[model samples]
Structures are given as structure tokens and as C-alpha cells.
Target: MYLLTLSESKPPNIVFIVADDLGWNDVGYHNPEIKTPNIDKLAREGVILNQSYVQPLCSPSRSSFMSGYYPFRTGLQHLVIISFQPVCLPLNISTLPQELKKLGYATHMIGKWHLGFCKWECTPTYRGFDSFFGYYNADEDYYNHSLSRVPFKGYFLDYRDDRQPVRDQDGVYSTHAFTKRAESVISQHDTSKPLFLYLPYQAVHEPIEVPKQYENMYPNIQSEGRRKFSGMVSALDEGIGNVTAALKQKGIYDDTIILFTADNGGWVSYYGNNYPLRGGKFTIYEGGTRGAAFIRGTGITGNRTYDELIHAVDWLPTLVSAAGGSVTGRDGQDLWKSISTGSGENRTEFIYNIDDDFPPVEGHAGIRYYFFIFFIIPMLPVLMGDYKLIEGYPGLFPDWYKPDTEMSSLDDPVEEFMAREGYKADNGYQLFNIKEDPTEHNDLSTKNPEIVAKLKARLEYYRKTFYVKPNFPILPDFAADPTKFNNTWSPGWC
Candidate 1:
């Protein structure tokens, strides 16, 4: 049972901000090397979530947050959707914005819409949001707002306003543009009705380009990637500050709930770092899944970090409940009351991800990078209470380390790590007492047979009940080329 009582007659406006590929230790509050004053201020003044977990990859974590179900339930457990894939988020689930609009909310979505847009029906505007402004894919050129990568080899524009291609934002930096759009939404909003704004950023991801001014802020850092990353984070922080100021200027700061989180762990190989947490993105490790997050505003008791376990799936129910809506059927538990009470007991178990073994299907979606092949391990991890069970290959990402010092480094460019003898056991299980071994130093699968067996049984049940197979859909040869439509990706051939 959950208890949340709001004093104001008007329902609270909910604003959720997500930073793509931001690491656990990349924030100023978490690591002193990073410069994020706005994010740090929010985290310091609000409740810091020390144990917030999300899926290891981009689309999976995003889909979970949007669908109120695990990636395994959405068929996004394997990998991200490429430009050529005909699938989007399953057309079945009633999205978060849809639920909010039922209570008379004006829902708006700004910045990255990586959930899925191959079909116009799956676009945020079509799905639920009254207004949508952003791109439909990942790793787009930050300045030109274009995506030119493998599978779709030319600079195809993915930025959009509702369904039409956005051709005007050619030279504008994506972060600044999205920030202005968000502020505009807040300023023009009808105050009498509640508003739900979802702003997912495109900062600090690959093609790690930030304006020279942001990179100039980090002169002392020697690594170019880390330097640019710090600057990108600064830009993101400043934009967040701008959004918060807009909320305050609208005279709704007290009645608005502002949440900030990275979609998943940092891309350590590039400009991300999840230091002090084992491994980086794509591994079923703590660094890959645990998020740096906080919730500030109405009903929040401020200035503290609530130390406990929470999952990305929980946000749907928690935010819906915070807005005075009922979430009767979802794979998530509302945690607002538990957070307010400092009980930290609303959740003690959650499955990190349920990944299927590689089947080597043609035209699978994967970032064409050295780290992508080295680090992307397909597996399952089920966390139950103090002991957590991992049933997959643990890639060789760097261990937790102090900042400014050289990172032990992300992943070794060799097959030895993935080919280690004990990497995948006979039964494919390894146990770690997360409460005790937070960095996951020791393996207890051999020692604690009963715990391993219990978690395995739980995984078996979840695997059987999954909504779809974890493997990504194979791209068909007849998929339409974006180049034919004047180099703009659209809901074509769907």
C-alpha cells in the first residue's frame, strides 16, 4: 500500500529530464571533477537516489520507463532499434503521457524520442503527447541534428516537430535548442491545468561534440574525450538550470515535481564514467544499470539521499500516483510514500534484464565501435534482497577508481576477457551480495548454491512469461532507404 497526500487543490505538474549516456560518477555531486552546478543543486536540495537502477542499454531502459514494463516484456531487451527496423515500442501498452492526459493534462515531449518511430502510430505525438519536439533515433550529429551511421550510411536528418522533418535547426546545438523548447513549453502552459513534460536530452552521447566553450571549461583534464564530456555535462546542467528557472518564473516551482536522471550508465570508453561502480554501459554490472538520479519538488522531503533499491519501471506508477492517478496494472510499484517515510522498503528485488544468447541474425543493430563489440554482453541479472545473481559474461570494463587519476581504463582490446575460463560457468551463474560486495569483487555462486538456485528459478519463470523473445528483429532487405526521401528518416514503409 502507498500513501501520498497533496495539499494544493490543483494537481502537480510533473517534469522529467533525462540525460543520455550520463555516467554514475559524471555529475559534480558524485565526483568533484565534473562540473554540474544545476544538477548538483537539485540533487543536494532534493532526495538523491543512491540505488536507482535502469536497463544497461539505451532503447531498453527508455522503453521500460515509457511502457511501465521491463525490456524483456517489450522485446527491446536485446539492442536498440536502427533506422531500418520496422518495429517501434509495442503498440499495445498505454504510455505514461496517455495515462496523465486522462486526468486532463497537457502532455509535451521534448528532446530524444528513442522509444520508436518507425511507424507514425508509434511517434510520441501519435502515442500520447499533445506536442512532440525531438529526434527519433540515437547518436545524431549534435549540431546538424542528423544521423549518419552504419545501416543508414548517409547524413540523414532525424530531428522532427511532430511528424514533419525539422529543417530549420541546422546549425543550432541540440542541447540549447531542446532547452529553449522546454522553457517555451513551461512559459506558455495553462496554469489552471496540470502539465506533464518529458525532456530527454541528446547530450554526452557519442560523436561527443560540445560547443568549444563547454570543452574550454575543462582545461586541466588531459584526455580530449573526458574534457569534451565534462563540457557537455556543463551545457546539460546549464540547460536544466534554464528549465528550472522557467518553472519558477511560471510561479509553479512549488507545485511542480522535477526529476533528473541519466537514461543508463555512462559510455566509459568515450566521455562517460561510472567510477566506484563496477563496469560501464552494456554489461550487467552495477555501473551499467545503476543510475544517478534525484526527485525534487512537491511531496518531497529535501536534502538527502535515500539509500535503497529502485528501478526504472517504478517511475511510471510513482509519477502517475504523484499526479493523483491510479496505476492498477503495471509491473511497477509506487515508491513516493516509501521515499517520504524513509522506509526504503517499497522494493527489494528487480530483474536488471533478461537477454537471449546471440543468434547472429543478419542486420542486427549495434554501434559500430570497438567498445560496442567488446562490451555488449547479452545475459540476465536478477537482484533478490542482499544477494544478486548474474548469469552471463561480465565484460572487461575498468574497475571503480578515483577521478583525475588515470582510469584503470574501460575495456581491454582482446578476446581474453570474454573468453576467460570461468566467464560463463557450466550452469551460467555467479552470485554477489550487493549489500556486502557492492563493487562485485567476489563470486559466491559456488559457495551459496541455494541462493543461486532460487534466483535461477525466478529467472526461469520470468523468461517463460516474457512478452517477446529478447533477440532484436532482423532487418529485411526490402526496407526503404532514407536517402530516397531527401535524406530524412520518416515513418516510411511501415
Candidate 2:
């Protein structure tokens, strides 16, 4: 795994870039209409992960990345750590940053930190980041850096420079701000220490706002939401380009490892296009969990696609191994060798998510979730040797959503598209041959009953042994109200 720089005797700098809620087909390499030239070049030059997998939600996938454990294990298998949720990536677990830092890596973080931020200890600085410049929540203002779920209720300022909230970031778009910070980190680094910059960009999530120039770049896109979403993607791509330029300028580009991936599938409700892959974000389907991932490091072979399975949980051990450290009891396997030389079993199976959260076993029989209905749906999906099994809550958005083409004529097409009602699983317990049908279109459960039973048994065993219930008190913590902290979602609320 370390063969790339093992001879040089210098640990390569690691830059793990995570995109928030980017769909499988959003990238230019996946979809030509999305003009992400920089990303396309990176994918073309890097080893594109053709079968990369992650959790179906923001916090769950991020928790997997940070903790090297599934959400069920961390009790974060439920919904995301909301602006008011009193949770953080359990403190006992050693995070990826902490592990790398223990091995003398200079760790830094920028952009979204939706893992948890209830107390000062749960914030990034306390979670082992040498320096953290970002917010603690999601869907904040692209410009003003505030989160406003209710129009007139008031906006919570969430942006921060380290632990102190930065009000001056009001005018700066997050993509630009984070990009500059990353460049500055590279430019100003001691160089004596290998840097680990975990930049989880806030683009392409929600509040899909971007500068007019970016919007102008996608003038051909008919739907306003899709155009804006594409623009946001471009903005993020530009930021990445800038960061890479900074790395090269600092003379560490060749000695750096850039791992780029989306946290989860796109939210079709917010104009995300997953194309042929069935189901959007918040689903167990391939479109929701199979991310667009690529790695361009010093040793990875370029112009190649790795079809082997790699999960979000693998990053912790893989990176720690690359940083010349040992991690014990992690659910992740070191892929440094497989990624570096393409000559190893890069994880044959992974739990897409063992969500022991909500979604009772009624299994798609009750009301559908997301539309504010308490739908009983399948929640868990595990992949073992190309066969995927979903135990409950198959998905919120149930089919392939291509807003760019499917309903391009509509000005704002979210409601109308859902109104059209694509498709859903007839029975809750669903199975698919992910190897052949990457889109979860064909259910092989009836024909392959043994496979389904085996996978279901695995889920039951997981539930019995390791599952930590995502039991949030049915009420939002009123004490977490932003008004208490001068109208900002700062730590120490809980």
C-alpha cells in the first residue's frame, strides 16, 4: 500500500475531498452535459471507482468515513445530526484525523462538519483537527453562512474560523472560502509534516445558490434548479482545481493523494440527477449508496476503473496505513495496496448501512417517509459478493430521477416529478444483483431465495449483536434553540 512512497521514505500528503449529496451521474465523466472538466480530467487520469459505496444519508456516510464504522455501530444510523441534535461521532472512537495526527500528520478540516456539534468536545478542533475552518451544520446559506429552515423564524449563523463563529464570512461563498483556506494550508504548511486536509465541500447540497457567472456557464440547462445545481458542482470543481494548483505550486502535488467522493446519492427533491440508477438519496438503492469516487495519488495507475467494492468506512484504515500508522479494531480494511497497485481483493463485501433507526418493519406498507409521512420502509442494505439485500425502507425517492432531461420544461419540478410517482418496491425485503444490474431495477429475491435469506440472516445477526438504536427523544431540544446563543448554531448548546 505504501509502495508508492515507501522507497522515497516520505509519507504522501492526503487530501480526502468529499462532495455533499452529489448524484452518481452528476459528474462530467458520468454525464457529458455537466461540464466538470477538472473533475473529468481527474477521473480520466485517476483510478475511477466504478463500484464505490457509501451510506445513503449525509451524517451516516460521513460517520462511516470519520469513525471507520457503520452508523448502526455508532448509533448515528438514524437521520442526520440535525442543527439541534445532541450528538457527535462518539468520542471514544479514534477518528481518521486523530489517527493520522497520532502519526505526525498535520491534520486540517474545512467545509461542512455535520457529524455532530452539541458540545465543544464534539467540534472539529476537539476531534483532532489541527485547524478547522467551517460550519457545524448543513444546508446553510451559500453566501451568508446561516441556516434557516423556517423563513421568518430567524437564521442560525454556523460558519466558524476554528471554534469562534466568523460573521465576516457572510458575503463569501463557501466553495471559494474553503478553497482559499485549503490553498493557504498547502502554501503555508511546514512541508516537514505530511498534511491531511479533509475538505468536505458544501456545494450541490441544498439552498442551491451560486454566483451568476457559474449559472451562466450552464445556460443550456433548462430547469432553473438543475442549472443552479450544475453551477454549484462547477464551483466546487473550480475549488478543487485551485486546491490542486496550490498543491503543485507548493511542490507536493506528485507526493499527494487526492481521494474525491460524494457523501451520498443526490437528493432528487433538490434537482439531483442519478440517471439510470434507480432511486435517489435516502435509499438503499445503488443510486443512493454507490458514489462517484476516484483516487489520483502518486502511485495509482491512471486511465483505469476499479470495479471492486470499496466502502466509505475503508478510508480511515486506508489513510492511517498510508500515513504510516496502525489502527486496531476498525471495520475498514487498508486499501492502500489495492489502490496503489490494483493487485489485491479490495473488500468483497460491505454493509451499505445497517440502520437500526426508524422505519418499522411494516416495510413499505404504511405511509411513505420524506413527504412528512411515517412510512414503514426497509432500512438496511448489505452487499456480499455482488448481491445486495435491503431489509426495510427501500428508499424515499424510489426511481431514477433525471431532472435535466425527464422534466426539463418545468421551472421548479420537484413536486410535479414526485407527483408523477415513479416506482417503489412491492415488498419490503428486496434483493438485487448489483454486479449485473447496477441500477437495482431487477429484484432477484424470488429467484435467488437462498441469497436473500442469507443476506437477511446477516442483517438479523447484525441487529442482535451490534445495532445501537437511533433513539432520539421524540421532541427537539428547545435548549438547542439558536436564540440562546445570539442566534447562531454554536457548540455548547446541549
Candidate 3:
């Protein structure tokens, strides 16, 4: 029973802006220090879901967002750059934008595409976006704009029209360029056709650099790195303002649904913080998974705050439902209605786990300072709000909080923990009643025996059911074996 009831009405446009490595408290709404008036306006005018989440890392969170599936189910459990291995997302699964494209929406992705590197199968165009203009690597020099390859150089801006390569000018800062592209896409959209703009900004991520204008705005911040990072965030905020203004100028403001959130929590140690919340980016702690988020447009009213539990995986189904499309097979539920009435009978809590790269491999020993060097290390999975279990090495690097430790163990499995394919490590668990303590400050495993028993049983079931095998494959356009194509550098970022 496919309903076309909205044929008489115009379909709403959608613009989803996701920031990378942005902290929960980084936005003006949360962080008092940062001056992000533009993003803050979005929060003020829209509903801010105080309890929204995503996977702790970039690729996994991105996979969950685009495909409406848990990262593990997509075989994207580990980060992509492992042993030059290409981990492809299963092609059969339909992505959110792909589904919307079927419903007559023009899709465009600007800026960071960390989902897959050179793998063909996972390219945004192959995954259902109508157009893509961005970098392929996880992180690129914000200023140089070149990709690593000579042909691509530091300034590789891939502009694709339905998968066919188009020309993108060289030498544009990633943050401003993404906004400019987004504005161009929005302005060019035919009023008759609905548009879906997917802008994932690389701003606020690493190699932090900001235009001097915004850099000078945060002169008060003492640390040089933190000040520069703040400037980058300000620039990103300004970019958001530009996109918002463009949407308004096109007269599509009321009929469009706009979403703003992060790919993961801020890299707290690197001048990012999700303060009052523990853990960050790589870990499954609240600070890692929890982030600032909001949705405004079409059916949403102003200034409402939804405090229910929602994950990145839920956005697809929820947005689909809002767009008058049918919600299909997925682990997510349409949260809009639930948040509206607060009476929907949906699953309450979910799990967040970052699995060890199948065969535990070692990482590089780079000479960069604590800020850039230490990030290469993979962290153990900390199941947020669940039976606070320590999977791999427990307290292996007690001094991990510090920046300048030697090249060390992100590889060795903590001997005490369990190590089985589909089961949890043999380590004991630490439970927390997250509703009472969002920080996981107090361990409740010993005090609340019954709750501990309940969550542990739940964890066992989840590990068996979802964490079976991860999805990994190259995009369809790339050669069968990526390395063989000397011209892999010919397209996108090689």
C-alpha cells in the first residue's frame, strides 16, 4: 500500500550537515566559550535532542547514518585504513539518499567522505548519491586541498555528476568550499524537484586550520592549538550560516528539513571536549558517542527539546517517515513521532561497540607530537549505558590521557579480558545507571546486582546477534584489485 497522498503537495527538501570530531559542548548551545552564532541559531529555532548518539568513530558512524544499519552489520566494525585493505559496504543494502532518490530527490555530498578510501563499492555515487564533490581520504590538508597523489595533489576536489567525473577547481579550503558547493547545489535546484543536500564538513577535524578572520576571534584562548581549533570551529559555524542563508534565499526554508549533528564526539584531548560526559571519540563512553544534534523543518515546530535516546541509525527511517515514505527493514525506528508524543513503544536502549580489527594488527610509530601521533591507536570498545564492560586491554595505557607517550600497545589484547570470535572478552563488567549518572562516574556493578545481571545478559545476546561479521568491499567503479589501477589516482582521491 504505497501512498502517494502528498502528490498534491510539494515534497520537502532535506539538508543534513554533519561535522566531524565536533564535541557535544563545542557548539554555542552547549559550550559557552565557543562563538557559533549560526549553528546556535539552528538550535534555537529547531528542536535539540539532548540525547542523540552515533558510533564513536568516523567510518562506522558514517556507515550507520547513510545505510540505516548498525556499523557491525555492515562489516564496517573497524576503521578503513587497515593494511591497505578495502572494506566495502554491502551493495545490496539501500542507502537513505538512494531511497530518497527513488522518491525524486536530487542528492549531493560535499566535503569529507571517510566511508571508504579508494574502494569502488563504497563510493558515494555507487551508494546512491546523485552527485559528490569532496575528498576521498579520511583527512586531507585543509589548506593545500590536494590529495596525496600527484595527479590529485593536496587539492583534490572530486566533482561527480551521477558518477561521471566533472571538474572542480583547485585550491579551496574544505570548510568554506563545502558551504559554497552546498549553496550552489541548493540554488540550482528546480523548484519542482525536491533536493537532498548531504554536507559532511571536514572542519573541526584534524590538521586544524582556520581562516585568519575567525582565528582572530578566539584570541583569548591561551593554548595555540586550542585557539586554532576554536577558529576552525568558528569558520565551520560561519559556513553553516552561509548554507542556511542560501536555503532561505531560495525560498525553500519552510519546506525543507535540516539536520545538524556530529559524526562522533570531539577529540577532547585535542582541544575538543564533551565535558560533564566521560570518554571521547574512540571510546564508547557518553562523551565519545553523545553529541549535539537537532532537526528542524517541514513538520517540526520551534524550540522543542527531545530528551529521548536516538542514534544516527535512526535518522534514515525517521526522516523517511517524515517525508511520507515507507520505513523499511532497519534496526532504527522513526523517532520523530515518538519524541513528539512520548508514548511510542520503541526500544529504549542500544549498544555501542567498536570491535578489534579482526586479526589484531599493530599500528605505525609516527614521530608527530602527542596531538597528532597518539590518535592512530585503536581503543577498546566501551559499551555506553550498558554493563560497562572492558573488552580488550583493560588499563593497558593508564597514562593514555597524556599526549607524549612512546610508540606502544593499541595492539596487544589485555591478557585478563576474554577473546573469542562472537563472545565478550572474559573480563568482568562495570555497570552504570546512565539515567542517573551520564558520566559513568560511579560503577554500579557491585551495588545493583540485579541490573548488572540484566544488562550482561542483554550484552551477550547483542554480541551473538549483531557483531557476527563486518561488511567490507571496494566500490563498484574501482578495479577488481584497487592497487592494480595506476590510474586509481586518475579519479577522486587516489
Give the winner by TM-score.
Answer: 2
Q: Find the candidate with the highest lDDT and give its number.
A: 2
- Residues 1-494 of candidate 2: C-alpha lDDT, one tens digit per residue: 23334326778899999999999889999988887988888778778998788888888889999999978788877667776667788999989998888788999999999988889999899998999999888888889989764322787788888878898877888899999999999999988888899999998898889998998998888888888988999999999999989999999988988999999988887888787898877777777778999988776666788877788889898888877777878778888778767886557556766654444211221110111123346543344346777765665776677666444345444445445643333446777766677777887778978877777777677678877877455567776888888888877766
lDDT at 15, model 3: 91
Model 3, CA-based lDDT: 0.66
- Residue 453 displacement in candidate 2 (angstroms): 1.4
Residue range 1-494, candidate 1, lDDT tens digits: 22233556777899999999999989999888888999998888788898888877788888878878987777887767777777788888988899899988999999988877666888999889999899998988898988765566778888888878899888999999999999999999999899999999998787779999999999999888788888999999999999999999999888888888888888665658887888777666788788999988877777877887788888898898888887867777889777655754467578877766463111111110000122336453343348777765543353564444343243432233344422332335668877778787888889989877777777777777764675356664245478777888777667
Candidate 3 Cα RMSD after full superposition onto the native fold (Å): 10.0
Using TM-score as the yardstick, the better of models 1 and 2 is 2
Candidate 2 residue 410 Cα shift, in angstroms, is 13
RMSD of each: 7.7, 7.2, 10.0
Alpha-carbon deviation at 191 in model 3, angstroms: 1.7
- CA-lDDT, candidates in order: 0.77, 0.79, 0.66
- Which of candidates 2 and 3 reaches a greater TM-score? 2
The residue-level lDDT of candidate 3 at 462 comes to 67
TM-score of 2: 0.90
TM-score, every prediction: 0.89, 0.90, 0.80
Distance from true location, Cα of 443 in model 2, Å:
1.1
Worst 10 residues of 2 by lDDT: 362-371
Candidate 1: where is the Cα deviation over 4 Å? 1-5, 359-385, 395-427, 476-478
